[model samples]
Target: MSGPRTIWRSIATGLGALALLVCAASANTASAQAPPPDIGFDQNLGAQLPLDLKFQDENGETVELKSYFGKKPVVLMPVYYKCPMLCGLELNGLVRCLRGLNMSIGMTAEKDFEILTYSIDHREKPALATQKRRQYLAAYDCPAANDGWHFLTGDEESIKKLNEVIGFRTQYDEITGQYAHAAGLVVCTPDGMLSRYLYGVEFEPKDLRLAVVESSEGKVGGLSEHILLYCFRYDPASGKYGLAIMNFLRAGGVLTLLILGTAITMMLRKERGMMESHRLLEGSTHG
Candidate 1:
């Protein structure tokens, strides 16, 4: 029978070997998949907006996307006000970023531009919209003078239309009781055309301002619109559009390397122990 030390070593080696195999398989799988092509900017930045949906405003007044055109630039966001997790964070991030901007929503307090958040979840009622709007407005801490922000909810047809137009794809995950949706903010020209896209939770103030100014045809100004030109591009491989890979890989590569290294170390330690044990047993037999 093997000694306790030898038995323990054997168990450790087995576990390490299993871990290594699992890691190697994962790595192979990742690499085997074709590398996604780099996504660049969409050339049709000024194309007309997609589906025209109808949603109720805070006061239950029906609001249509087409109506907003020729009025003021709009910040279009798709979110379910009742979302328990990421939605709130996304909104909070936007509110924080907007509050820090030197520019106000409207130039003369007549609602120059509007921040419209449409609830993708059709079940969401007008009351929920009001509550969410109030909650976010309170957090925003903007003076009463700034009333350009709006929260809205609509029926399925309207929601689908708006989502389709903006390329906002989302699905309900029954297991998690939550919706899986991409997070981003879109800037539309006053004439209801796609202007720019800002992906992820935290948005750059300069980018946001630039998008607004560009969408306004260089009327509003803070920074150059060139920065907003390629805020987000579409990648064919990932089957989803997002920030450039160079930026994504910078954050993802470190964690990946750490996991791979740990698996390799465990595997090497396991092999060494097995070899040492075999040598010890052979020596004892020869003696």
Candidate 2:
């Protein structure tokens, strides 16, 4: 027994030494690597937007960010036209989700929503924005796409300020001459308050539509969506809405009770109507 114990102790000591060596090597490798991108999605939900900044639209006309606010919620995306990889993936994902929504873009439809995309690359010109818009709008191919989607460009200061409010981060890679960014979109309320955030390259249509509906504060979606809100709640860490088991159970129970009560009332009314009809028939016969 003592010999076996001594052997086990020796093995443990060796394993601990090996783990320390591996950790030291990993630290050295990390230090040698180009610093990891500072880009990521931070969920700053329910924050008020900074709408005072200025940006230029696709047509080269300067526009106030606040002008896009009011009356309808906005699906906001920060991307640069020249990005070699991640930005295109983000846009493609966004368009895919948009195609799934029956709702149109622009405030002309009370139930519709809008998309506001701005480039973080301060040096990008309006021509690039215009070109990007035309390409996407053609792909979207809806008559209302003309009015629904807007591409914007702005100076570095304005871009930084807006991104700061949304907690979106991006960094330029000096070695690669490209921008590094995470994939996500922000939804702002009709009055320009940050409402929902969705992360990743592929967004679920249900998630996208529900996010827009919530941000609109029931001004856009029907009663069904409002009912769904009762069962499903937003999850901050995952950046998606998930099921609320207890709330769902409670809602189901109440609906069942209401249905049973209505059935009983209907039966009572039918029984009373039959009795009155029978009494009237007997009285007529005796007369």
Candidate 3:
């Protein structure tokens, strides 16, 4: 049989080697799958808001980006109101998430934020905006309609400018008869500057709140800022926003294994030392 010291060393070495293998496997997988591009906000966050872009609302009233600034943070989405799949799903998700939030776009006595859904399809009519707004509003449980949401339609020039500024690349897929685009939400400061981009359909309410509050520069309250610290962030490799699952999981798993390995190593070392001490004492007594 191998000596106790050798056995202990072997066990420690085996565990360490196994842990390293697992880490290498994880790293390889991550490397093989690169993340999307970075579309997150920076110091020049809202400068891309096309101030000259003008779109008409459901009521046919012309609205400009400049008109929205300094009033309330805008949750702008570039979606064709007629989108058959992802667009509807995205809107539904936003509505569902917003319904659970305590803050109201218009009703919270402070006029905190507002929702604007801009139709990227220039051919989309104001009537379509009216219809979509009606459908979503009918389903919306919020009673404060006066200050909260607005569905808008605009001409091609306005749509193009707005889409370009927001980096919303949408294409008409004739084969599918649908717009091929990524699903996301963009938060703009009241001054019409882009602040945060929440990519994906289902977004956390806390993240939405922080984006609003931060864009407002703490002008709006009654919500916590903690969620923004750990919530969904932008990844540049994939060119779309998503939940930060890999980062969190990787960090958590590595730390856990490190702790377990350290404990096991210490225990094995202590056990081997005791065995050596016993052997030496016995030898000394006999001698």
**What is the C-alpha local distance difference test score of each model?**
0.72, 0.84, 0.74
Query: What ranges in model 2 sit over 4 Å off?
Result: 1-29, 32-35, 103-111, 266-287
lDDT of 2 by residue, 89-157 (tens): 888887777666644433222237778999999999899999999888776656655687899999999
Task: Looking at model 2, report the run of 10 residues with the lowest lDDT sum.
Answer: 102-111
Error of 1 at 229 (Å): 9.5
Better of 2 and 3 by lDDT: 2
Q: Rank the candidates by TM-score, best first.
A: 2, 3, 1
Best candidate according to TM-score? 2
C-alpha-based local distance difference test score of model 2: 0.84
Error of 3 at 175 (Å): 4.0
lDDT of 2 at 162: 86
Query: Can you rank all candidates by lDDT, best first?
Result: 2, 3, 1
- Estimate TM-scores for all models: 0.61, 0.80, 0.62
**Clashing residue pair totals per candidate (backbone < 3 A):** 1, 0, 15
lDDT of 1 by residue, 1-287 (tens): 56998999999999999999999999999999966543232323566774366779888898776765676788888889878887888898888777766354323211446788889898998899888888887776666524777888888987876676667777687787678777777888888888778777777665576567667886665343433334444433332335656645654787799999999999999999999999999999999
